[model samples]
Target: MDSYAIKYIGLLCLLLAFVSCKKKNQNSLPETMKKDFVTINYAKGFSIEKPASGITIIKVYSPWPDADEAFTYALVPKALQTQPQLNEKEFDAIINVPVERIIATSTTHIPALENLGVIDKLVGFPETRYISSEATR
Candidate 1:
């Protein structure tokens, strides 16, 4: 072979080696490890502890009427009485008392009480048809 042909073949081999090496390095990362990477925002001077896989966050209204009713109904179960920060333009925290017995007068109140697991604490009702099954009747 001519010197020029040999030099051209050598250059082609070098280029192919570099391209294959680049591809191998890119694929060296495990797919699961790459997929699990997440971005988190932290407030100034705050750091987060790594969360467990099944941990969940739910946004709850702070100091809701149900919270008050729960408070009045049974002195506020420790799990439900957390005072969350309120949005100044929309809602405000009015009361922090423990609830025991709820007297539901409006249609909306019964459903709210039932969802909080305090349906049995509903001792009195004004309008009855809205409630299912005349059990309370």
Candidate 2:
């Protein structure tokens, strides 16, 4: 192979390694709690951590290249879910899991919801014209 082809292959290998090695939260969890955390499949820019205390933490990384902020969500147990607590301020958004209904704002989100087989969870869209998917209608 030419020098340019060899260089391109080397560059591609480095790029793949960088993306694959992206850091994940390293917070320690109890052995018992680790088994209860739901495994998120085929997802990017998010991580879930559940402590034995019963509250679940979800960290969502901003997809935008220019955005430096990431959002945190705390899912409190049913009994204490309604009561506001001091730590609630740390989360960007928090609510009970199995969110009943949501207004899907973009078409790009449709595929992810569809892939999760939860397209029925969407109750509305900002603009109907952009939704070309018949399944979403």
Candidate 3:
């Protein structure tokens, strides 16, 4: 074969190798988010992706009325179980699994959080008097 043809074939092989490596990396879970997790069906403004073990990435777009900014939160599931050995730098929030403590600002979030059995995690609410939850009462 001609030298030019040989060089082209070598380059093509290298490109193919690079592409395969990238696909493999994308398909493999990162060390932090490898464990099992529940799928969250979120609204239009938010989406989730698990790229590693014990971690979840949340993307929020225009989450607030009249707001134009988008934000991201990297959450660690069963945080207490993983946080001891986890690199905290990998996540934006490290809420304990079966959450134990929380401060609530809106009653709107109560019912869903309560139904999840994690409402007990609320230790404080700014409007305690407004809350009528039988569990909290």
Candidate 4:
């Protein structure tokens, strides 16, 4: 495909992603929901936390080489009616949980996305030749 076509597709994907995610959850999250979480012990790349029920907080540290700081994001379950109020500076983004789509840069992330049953959500990736998965290609 030409550059124009590639750009158009990427833009369309982004627009579609944005539109699909704009819906609000009609039910408010349960106040009594318990926190369920996994412990991140070895990987310095990221850490996960559950500060509240129906919310998952992720902090990625030095995701890239020479990165000085971590990026934080809040993930709320789709069933949640409203996002909990949080300090603005605490998170880079507050996204609905169970992401609908993704654009992967590194091939290392492909397997995980696939395993999560979201590989079909791959909107774009560079160097298609490097991708061995027939499903992805």
Q: How close is candidate 3 to the true structure, as a TM-score?
A: 0.55
Give the per-residue Cα lDDT of candidate 3 at 41: 69
Runs with alpha carbons beyond 4 Å of true place in candidate 4 = 1-38
Q: Please provide, for model 3 over 1-137, each residue's C-alpha lDDT reduced to its tens digit, 9 standing for 90 to 100.
A: 99999999999999999988884346765575565434656547667776655456676777789987777666556643644655556554555544567788888778877888887778888877788787775
Per-residue lDDT value at 51 in model 1: 22
- What lDDT, from 0 to 1, does candidate 4 have? 0.80
Q: How many residue pairs clash in all the candidates, one count each?
A: 8, 0, 7, 0
Query: Of the candidates numbered 2 and 3, which has the greater TM-score value?
Result: 2
Over 1-137, each residue of candidate 4 has an lDDT whose tens digit, in order, gives 99999999999999999999997876755655545567877776887877556578888888799998889988878887365566668889888767777889998988888798888888889888888888877
> Rank by lDDT, descending?
4, 2, 3, 1
Ranking 1 against 3 by TM-score, winner: 3
lDDT of 1: 0.48
RMSD of 1: 14.6
Candidate 4: worst-modelled 10 consecutive residues by lDDT: 28-37
